[model samples]
Target: MKRSTKITMVVSAAVVTGLLVLALPAMIGATTWVTGVFGAGSGSPAATEPPNPTADPASDDGLVDLGDGISVPAGGPGECTSTAHISTMSTRTDDSGPYYSKLIGDLVDRGPSELASGQALTDEAGGVYAYEVAAGDSAIAIGERFCIDYITVQSHNHVRAGMIHAGNILYLRPDPTLPWVSPYEPFDVQPGEQTGPYYDAIDFMRNAVVAQDLAEAQRVWAGLGPHIHPDARTIATRALEAGDWELLRQMFP
Candidate 1:
């Protein structure tokens, strides 16, 4: 893991802990929008701190890929729900547990505890990349450690350009295809500081419109706008091309 990513991971653990403690109840009481499986969003800078191996358990199974092509490892499950909602999920669960019960170490564990375990960082597709940043670590350095492009890492994680911290978890995975891209292409973006829940909103719009489920699209787009990237454009262009002005106006307007 890269230093920046590690720092992000450590901060993510603390944030999840705090969120579960503070925000879980409100979410449970409300509609509890499904955000985790969608997009990324902003949060405090505290999450950019790197992990301390002595303080953080370096070897644990803190990751579980949701098979929807989204991987939720312990550290950077950005903007997720405190309570799990299985019924609405489109992916199979590899592990299930309450947020509070999960330990800080177990949740942030990247691989196994020892090289002898055969689950060492070397076992990963790319060798385990690790870094340590104090007050001086550049955002570019952090991005390099994690093997993510500077922009994608920064934008997706909601960080300022060229800013990061120390003791972070900078784990890397080969870039995967974004779920909503192929059609939207180059315009896939979140307006403002939008995050996970917004992606759910986008997904809802996508299903309703592209899937030819007009009612569903209408239901979700009730609050959408022209500024919404890619999808809004894709949907509008398709609607206009097909002479479905009603759908285009409803979605883009």
Candidate 2:
């Protein structure tokens, strides 16, 4: 081989090596970029599968376990027997005979029109009330106590599987105009804001006056003692005694 030819070959080989060195880094970088963008090859970690969706609460026949041994059906009352729903009444007790008597007298004077058309007087419907569930209090018992249907109680409060906790506020008397809704959509109002109990008491008094049964009115008044606010009870007691239905109306209104 000629010396000049050998030198030319060496220079060509060096240039080729230099090009390879420069291009190798760019090739590696391109591979890494492709891997990152497309998640190709075992060099990259496998993509995490999207987390499984949460289970729906309405599944499993929509039966709600309200703790205790009780379980009630959700949605509209389905084969819900009143006897099965009723439980022992709450142990709390109350007595305000004179006040009840006076209230009964007032209801007698006012007549059924006042009771029937509660909206006319207070701008609120009659028979709607808020009740905190007590231990052993079932939908039917609460309904019977308030002279309402157990199914109505369950449907109104959306009580699932007859499940009612002790502190849960059950609203009585659903709006007649509104379409039936699922249990997931509850009423917007809180327990304290509900005036149904007061009106319920008044209704019972009115019923007793209509039946001409002072004893029944007194019994209803006693049952209502625990449900009524102490302040409202005091005001009601005074108002009934003083024949100041206007004051009673103000409190209820």
Candidate 3:
């Protein structure tokens, strides 16, 4: 063959090879392959992975200090409970007058079912603090003891005529809401502001606690961690000192 004809044939083969390489990816997959040559239009290493939902509370290198010693990465709820349950009145539950005293007695003489309703309530909803109840305690008094609104307690638990009964399970609200204001997404209010949406979110969480939805309760608590006000820090401090981690996890600096 002539030298010029041989050169033309070689150039045609090279062009075909380049086109085949470009079309190979699309042939292998149904989706169109439009990636730029080399590294063009590629994602960064960080974009390839999902963000971590669980974090170690101990690490605080990049956290911001919000003053008065409050900071992000302060932490979240402590260990979660294995299972969620509430107590129901059994045949032996006392129904006599002075139900509060009987309730206390029932707690003192609790069985080996390994029941700890106080801890259960705390884990499920971050309500209720003391492991024991008083002889003369009413729903209102219980609320007062825990530093929550009496109405909030009564409303949350569906109490009627302020009546008391032995062996009845109650959720406690030991911390005041002011100190740990939250910027949680559900409660879309200014850091220090308390508006309609905030209260709605609170009601949603309260209902979740009453319903014993542990997962939902924890989620809301985490979102509300940043709006805590300094004035209410004392109340928050007391609750944390008492180990009310579920509620404590909701407050922000």
Candidate 4:
């Protein structure tokens, strides 16, 4: 064969091979990613894999272990017997007299003052803290509790000090509204100057508690107990009176 013809054939073959390699990926569709056990065939039911073993609370870190704390099973309510007239009524109001009504009125009026004093108590103990903030939290108090500066929290969440509500999550870093040069550094604030938001947040929480929105109220009240005005004792009292163990646990635990 002529050298030129041989060279031409070799070059054609090389170009065809390169084109095939590039087209191979496009020719085959992307592979499907199947999670868990796939069926043996199209008509077969999915093969059942053994369930993941549940972790024992006693063996888990951060879990309350038996002997360390009483374990309540995750099922139904435990034994709580009420007294006569109602097996669970811890104390019966004497319906035969107007005296009990006055006592109830007095209890209602005294709640806010108690919550205010409760805040002072927490301050004294140095336990004010914030775990998370949804839009419902007092942005100012959250900033104070997490040691995030107030101005930054307000700007990041896009609310004035008093506008935050129950479900706003503020990003500590990369929130362009603050003067913080480094996002990771810890900081603290004096409580009273930026408390309007905190007060408003608590007021909303009080209403929720009164409305029997215990879980919602507890969520709002979760970490702000120290910040709660002693007057909140009224709210707490309502929670206690209503026998809401979960809310009470959040408050006093």
Candidate 4 lDDT over 202-227, as tens digits, reads: 44554564465767766666644445
Give the root-mean-square deviation of each candidate in angstroms.
19.1, 36.1, 31.2, 30.8
Cα shift from native, residue 204, model 3 (Å): 2.0
TM-score of each: 0.21, 0.23, 0.23, 0.20
Task: Identify the candidate with maximal lDDT.
Answer: 2
> What TM-score does candidate 1 reach?
0.21
- List per-prediction Cα lDDT, in the order shown: 0.30, 0.32, 0.30, 0.28
Worst 10 residues of 3 by lDDT: 97-106
RMSD versus native structure for model 3: 31.2
Q: Estimate, for each residue in 156-199, the C-alpha lDDT of model 3 and write its tens digit.
A: 23333455444344533222112223222221234555455654
Q: Candidate 3 regions off by >4 Å?
A: 1-194, 230-253
Worst 10 residues of 4 by lDDT: 100-109
For model 3, the local distance difference test gives 0.30
Off by over 4 Å in 4: 1-192, 229-253
lDDT of residue 214 for candidate 4: 67
RMSD to the native, candidate 4?
A: 30.8
- lDDT tens per residue, model 2, 171-217: 33221211222222112224446556554665565455345455664
